[model samples]
Target: MIELDNVSKTYGSTRALDSIDLTILPLRTTVLLGPSGCGKSTLIRLIIGLIKPDEGSVYVEGELLTPNNIFALRKRMGYVIQDGALFPHLTARENVSLIAKHIGWNRDRIQNRIVELCGLTKFPVDALNRYPAQISGGQRQRVSLMRALMLDPDILLLDEPLGALDPLIRFELQTDLKEIFKTLGKTVLMVTHDKGEAGFFEDTIVLLRDGCIIQQGTLSDLVKKPADPFVTRFINAQRSPLESIQNKADSKVF
Candidate 1:
């Protein structure tokens, strides 16, 4: 579990986060939904200790997350960035086991963990020796996910993990991700600009705008009981093909 208390961060004149107060539920997924520059990614970085908040504090499992304890607390959480961020020179196996190797995990242990992760992520064993360029975008993301889970982390942080894939691949991965999350039952924090993606996850939704939280609730709550005018506007902004047609029909326009 993670908590942000009265947190604020700024870059030059831009306020990345403004007095955020949140508590991440244990063994549940929480998606940060918003447009770009809405501070969704910044919030993730703050939770992972990639950057320190200019004001207030971050806590993990009831313990304060400070410089002294961040590294330790961070290890308990796994992070997968956009595009997977895999190393081109390393094979998928090497990449997934990189952290384990660095931490002096014995070969048997490392291999065992890698094998387990491959199965968990549904990655093929035959592809283990392939480099990032040798795999599909979805496979690369799977590799990234495997690497994140190598340590068996208690929490997972995903920043637009499926954004780069094609629609079909993205949908497939979405289903797989949902199943994996349910199977593991770890605390999960994900970021996405896509309302559909947020709804597909069927988890807690935290909608943000202009570096501040606009609303936090289930998708149905947001649809029927918007906390602000902006929330309704944001929700309406991302429309499916059916919704688009309905909107045009409702207006009697071509």
Candidate 2:
């Protein structure tokens, strides 16, 4: 449903993205997986129409993502950045219902949507009444997601949504997020530096380096046949030595 045709973006002497041509399918999670300084976030911003491409074009659904059409296009997509990006002054419920209220939704409809979103995200009912500062980091992330999904958008863009949480909380959120996606069946484009997270959460993974796509495929495709030594090493490093131990144990038991 989204296509990037020969797109490029430059900043002074450096190119953040160079002739990047990619298409993201609907009703599936596609991950932009790469290390820092790899231009993943730049791609996300371009798709969101936050910045114009230096060349080519970005198309959402079928329309060109231009200034004139960006407003209406954005309303059909949801985005969650690194931090929860919640309003510190507003309660969780307030944050979620803010957009609906802005669109002139009545109290009853807004309240019902808030309730439904909270239930869908499994955010605690009591936490909805508290300000952002009153909740834990994980809770704040959930609230951010709730806010993004509040509008019931067709596409979801998540930029390292669990990047800042503690390891334990991060793991929990990852599983919860996967379950939520499976249940909702919303098309998602998630950008993350964590290879494990990308492999575990995505149906297809696109590996980028220096503003270009190096490889894109399923987890098995990447692990068994990385495009080059760099990708091979990158994927190998993420596999723990404990995997050998588990293999040996399974062999003995079987």
Top candidate, metric lDDT? 1
231 in model 2: Cα distance from truth in Å? Answer: 1.0
Whole-model lDDT per candidate: 0.93, 0.91
Q: Point out where model 1 deviates above 4 Å.
A: 244-254
TM value for model 1: 0.96
Report residue 126 deviation for candidate 2 (angstroms). 1.5
Clashing pairs in 2: none
lDDT, candidate 1, at 156 = 97
Distance from true location, Cα of 102 in model 1, Å: 1.1
Model 2 CA lDDT for position 181: 91
TM-score of structure candidate 2: 0.93
CA lDDT for candidate 1: 0.93
* TM per prediction: 0.96, 0.93
Residues 11-130, candidate 2, lDDT per residue (tens digit)? 998899999999999999999998798899899999999888999899999899999999899988999998888999999989988888988999998888888888888899877899
Clash total of candidate 2: 0
